[model samples]
Target: MKTESTDANTSDQGLITLAHGAGGRVMRQLIESICVEAFNNPALALLEDQARLDMAEIAAHGDRLAFTTDSYVVDPLEFPGGDIGTLAVNGTVNDLAVSGARPLYLSCALILEEGLEISRLRRIMASMSDAAGVAGVSIVTGDTKVVPRGKGDGMFINTSGIGVIPQGVELAASRCQPGDCVIVNGTLGDHGAAILQARGDLALEADLVSDCQPLHGLIARMLAVCPQVHALRDATRGGVAGVVYEFAEASGRAIRLFEDQLPVRPSVRGVCEILGLDALHFANEGKLVAVVPREAADSMVAVMREHPAGRDACIIGEVLDGPAGSVQISTLMGGVRLLDLPIGEQLPRIC
Candidate 1:
């Protein structure tokens, strides 16, 4: 039983140094005081190179497993509504949840830049712990590395998640039928807009905050009401617009979206307008875009609205049969136009 030395300093005033990643006393102190303390769990308590789980426990849940990984490099590390830590957990959890899985475990890896503050790292770890607890998932294994100053950003997180897929639930882009309805859980582009503001480059201020949150709970509720959902995706990097184009291309169908129905917050709209950006091309963290049979659309929206994370849920569009592999938007002026995928990076380093 290896125990951390009590003489080690765990004060907030401490700053991270390259030696902390040298896999010696300093590294042990950093892990014990920050990572282990925040993500306290039986599996992680063992301190093994990998987390071990009882096969019986895993088999009892379902017959299939869903695994996914995502990396976070949002430039500001910390944002208005969430930091990289919270985004790391939720992003991984949402990846599995959207595949109709119940997230079980997560593996977190951190890349720290030299000169980073220890207190900031602790705060990030705490946020990750809270997010994991909220989603009923455990952070079981992790690794840390430190890079030279200016080499790595302040911090970057890579999270991989394992989940159990529920029986009788199947989701895929190919399952989207021509008549399927398109639904979004909430407003679009909040995360992208918030990140831009966090950078302080725009010098624009609004009441906008990143819509970063865990969506598994909200997804669970929707599944309860409509188990036959055709497809599900959390609008992240490319926003709902990107998701629409991808699905259209994959399903060999066209997507028709009503611009008037998109749930963009007033503040988010202002940010996009001033910056000459399209809200659909921006990113989001907490929003989900789902496709369901036309018959179940209303019921799904109703159930989603009951959850706090989905109060703004609405059906924004529907799948179309012709004009395959294309996305079109209906303007409020009764005109229809192509909604092309953004050419280059609208916002860089956005998770």
Candidate 2:
């Protein structure tokens, strides 16, 4: 076994090793040379144990702080439209965004497997930096650890984010009311379909790409026009169906969705048809579901359409008075079917 001092003196051989996580010179160098260089912000440069934030600056954005965290272990880290790095930043940003917050800062933690290429790590770090820039959030502090090659995958990322919810911006599933309009920003299931195809588990071909993007900006635009928006959720993991179910359960109201209004891309629809899947249940990283009073629905959608992310914005459903805590979908065949949450994840590690 190599002594700590000896390991600290050794240089990186273009691959990650256990020494990189030993909390010694090697670990410090890895963080300073790669992670710090990628995210060169003042707060992160301090190299403090915890990020020192300006409370006054935070207070200027809103009265309450909105915080969220998520982990990404998506198989085949790099997909068509994004990679695990992009997902790490955007995922946490969206978590705060859906709560009507202005996403601000993020903390990244990496678990790397030994023998991973240094070049790959650099590329992933750069991706994370770029994604933070796009989301207008700073990566303030982070930690890194290396595990044995077989003990971990290529890498896993965990991101925690903080934002501020402006005054009067109270959003929750309990606020959903009957007659409220349910709207989606864009096509659903693109991310899930893209990941499925990227995995190359089946001999399938489709021009699908992950819709993994930061939704905070688009959500801000929606809230600016319609502050009365009741509930908002990024349709991830369990997808739109999952979000609708949450709203129903929280508000004790029924949600009815119109199948025809759901905007699903042709490639995604094709993938679903070939695999016996429903686009409604597929995961999406960039899409969101919103519930707003009927009076504000049209204007809200109009504003949403003005943004790039919401170009395909449309109302897909409405809150109903019958059958509390139930979600039903009106299929194109003029038949209604209960849209229940999946007992098991259709696409594991999808986000």
Show pairs that collide, candidate 2: none
What are the per-residue Cα lDDT tens digits for candidate 2 across 188-289?
999999999999997877788999998989988888888899999999999999999999999999999999898999988988999899999999999999
**Candidate 1 deviant stretches above 4 angstroms:** 1-9
Residues 1-351 of candidate 1 have per-residue lDDT tens digits of 344434345567777788888898788888887898899999998889999987778778788999999999888989899999999999999999999899999999999998888889989999999999999999999999989999988899999999988788899987789999999998899999999999999878687799999999999888888888989999998888889888898999999999999888899899988978999989999999999999999989998998999999999999999698999999999999999887787999988
Report lDDT (Cα) of residue 88, candidate 2: 93
List candidate 2 stretches off by more than 4 Å. 1-13
Record all residue pairs in model 1 with backbone atoms less than 3 Å apart, i.e. clashing: none
